[model samples]
Target: MASRGFIELLRLADMARARKNGRQGGQESDWQGIVFEIGGQRLVAPMGEVSEVLTMPEYTSMPLVQPWMLGIANIRGRLLPLTDLSQFLHVPSRLSQMSQRKVIVIDHDSVFSGILVDQVLGIEHFNRSQYRSEAIDSKSPFAPYNHGKFFKDEQDWFVFMPSLLAQDSRYIDAAI
Candidate 1:
């Protein structure tokens, strides 16, 4: 009887360890990514990691700045650089009637920056398994930005890694 109880305990422990591993491995984990609107595009981000999202505000332009740099904006009295991700993604900046403009605040390695977008859609959740490795066709202008693809209905959703986007040479001031 003691041997049987020991085996049962061992099985329970094994199951517990599996559950812990799944949670820590970032798969079917409690946390999920978020999807938002940027211009005509819908972007998915790992929710809480994004600091804030606001309406497009007046910004003070910097001389000789990159085209994607929409200048600086005062947020709650703090100055933050605003980037036009649409332009950075090489997409056109024209606004349409349905466009909902907003600024997406992001942080990387404690450095904070905001992205100007044409709209703020909403959020979405998915298991990490939902994403699969895939190649972007040469015809896609978004080819360079795609990290991998997921799905929703008949549409294929592309997932862009935040670290890659944050570390883009365009966003970092090379001179500094």
Candidate 2:
């Protein structure tokens, strides 16, 4: 009887370990996406796809590129197209007159694009259930890029999903 009880305890311990691993691996629905700062506003993106955050650098400008396209910057020898999040998201760029901006380079199914941001706040994980899909403002051109509304403390923020922007043909066809 004693041996049987010990085996049962070990099984319980193994089960607990598996559950912990699953939670850390983000296999649960409660996992909130990662959040970063851009233009003094908090934006959230799915944690699984964020490649890296980089500081502003010189990028080759494309002729006749769309207004939102900032240019292409070489990152670690790889030239990546950088789009200004301020213009893409339709937010004011000169709000604080940023001197040291950053880029959040994202890779979607092998396609890469560097998203320009004012600054990076950091990474954070929150439950997806906590996010509410707010109605898009009709007047804003960037409504399609917004995922929904989220709150951090008493301040409400808009969440921009980069995948939606990446899928847009304008971003893909732009030349540098």
TM-score of each: 0.68, 0.68
Q: What is the lDDT of residue 109 in candidate 1?
A: 89
Which ten-residue region of model 2 has the weakest summed lDDT?
A: 1-10
* lDDT measured at residue 148 in model 1 versus the true structure, 0 to 100: 71
Instruction: Pick the lDDT winner.
Output: 2
Task: Encode model 1's per-residue lDDT on 85-168: one tens digit a residue.
Answer: 777777765574312466767777856788776764554445556666784565765566566766656666665556566776
Q: What C-alpha lDDT, on a 0 to 100 scale, does residue 159 get in candidate 1? A: 58
- 108 Cα displacement, candidate 1 (Å): 0.7
After aligning candidate 2 to the native by TM-score, how far in Å is the CA of 50 from where it should be? Answer: 1.7
- Candidate 1 segments whose C-alpha is farther than 4 A from its true place: 1-31, 94-100, 138-141, 174-176
Steric collisions counted per model:
4, 2
lDDT of each: 0.62, 0.65
Residue pairs clashing, model 2:
32-126, 32-127
